[model samples]
Target: MSCLKQTVNVNKAELMKNYIKKIFAMLGILLFKVQGQIEDRTLPTFATYPKRLKINLPRNIANPQHIYIGDNVKFGPGCFLLALTEYPTSKMRNSEFNKATQKFNPVIKIGDNVTATAYVQISALERITIEDDVMFASNVFVGDHQHGYQSAATPYKYQPIWKINPITIKKGCWIGQNVIVMPGVTIGECSIIGANSLVNKDIPPKCIAVGSPATVIKKWDDQSQIWIKS
Candidate 1:
């Protein structure tokens, strides 16, 4: 009788241990599910969301609330998009953008099917609009404002950023690698800017531009259906 009682007690203890292990396993599963949901957390603070916005790595994106993006947009790694609300200056900052309310205003607007590859930077103080199907290669820099250098004694960083002009890149434009689109520039539709081009002025439609200031080297002649050397 003593031996039977000891066996029963041992069996009950083993059952309890198995029950505890099951409970721990269930808790672990629940925790993993919750962690997965957290990983897929998309910030609701965005003003809008495209049906498919694939961002490999969001880097140096300041004030994304004002950045408007269209459908099927993909941002590659090391892409920097900054719509400046407040400058780095202690005294002079946000004079025109949001002086009274200091709010997030729309600045960088990217249209549908736009892709900016690795290390593409878009810094806009006023506005920068990229139309549909615009492709930007690696290391492309587009900005609408430049740092003030009026005061010789003061450092450039300390000075305010003045809006040069709003930049507009029209639809179906391909900006190659190492291209720099400066302030007040407008790139026309279906234009191909060559690599290492510095575009400071307007580029006509269906033209192939290259070199600094982006001179139009070849213009597409729709009449002859051939490219004419400009």
Candidate 2:
């Protein structure tokens, strides 16, 4: 009788252990569902979001009203896009005077089918227009303004001027990794900018540019149907 009782107790303990494990498993599933819901809520729905737009988490968008993104745009993690409606006077020397005089209503218009990888930073103080089918690799910086220095005595950070000319990236351009497109520069259509290049001037269409202050290395020849060295 004692042996039977011991066997019954062992069976009950095993059943309870399994019941406890089942409870813990259910709790884990519930936690996962709640986490998914929280992540879904964090994605911002813009007023002008186009069809099939997929943006990963941790995207920083400043002045969302001034920024416009077109259809089928995909942004990877750590993308920082800033379209300043007003100039950042705190960074300038004549803060109060510049704030009163300057009218900085910047616009960042990203055209359709654009893909930007991780850590792409676009600072538009005046205007940064990215045309259709542009691809930006990781750590690409496109800014329309730079810190200015009016006098030799003054520091560069003290004078910040928004460039009058905008930064325009024409259609079907592929900007490589760690490329910096500076103010008043225009990247022409179907151009491929090599990795780690700094674009300080205008790049013409259908060419391959490389290096710091990128120079045209090759150009597409329509007559020969090949890329000729520039």
Taking all chains together, each candidate's TM-score versus the true structure is 0.75, 0.76
Q: Count the backbone clashes (under 3 Å) in each candidate.
A: 0, 0
Candidate 1 lDDT by residue in tens digits, 116-169 = 888999988788999999999999999987877878876666666665699999
Residue 141 lDDT in candidate 1: 96
Give the whole-model CA lDDT for all candidates, comma-separated: 0.84, 0.85
Clashing pairs for predicted structure model 2, backbone only: none
Candidate 2: C-alpha lDDT? 0.85
Model 1 spans with C-alpha error above 4 angstroms: 1-44, 89-106
Mind sharing the TM-score for model 1?
0.75
- RMSD, each candidate, Å? 9.5, 5.7
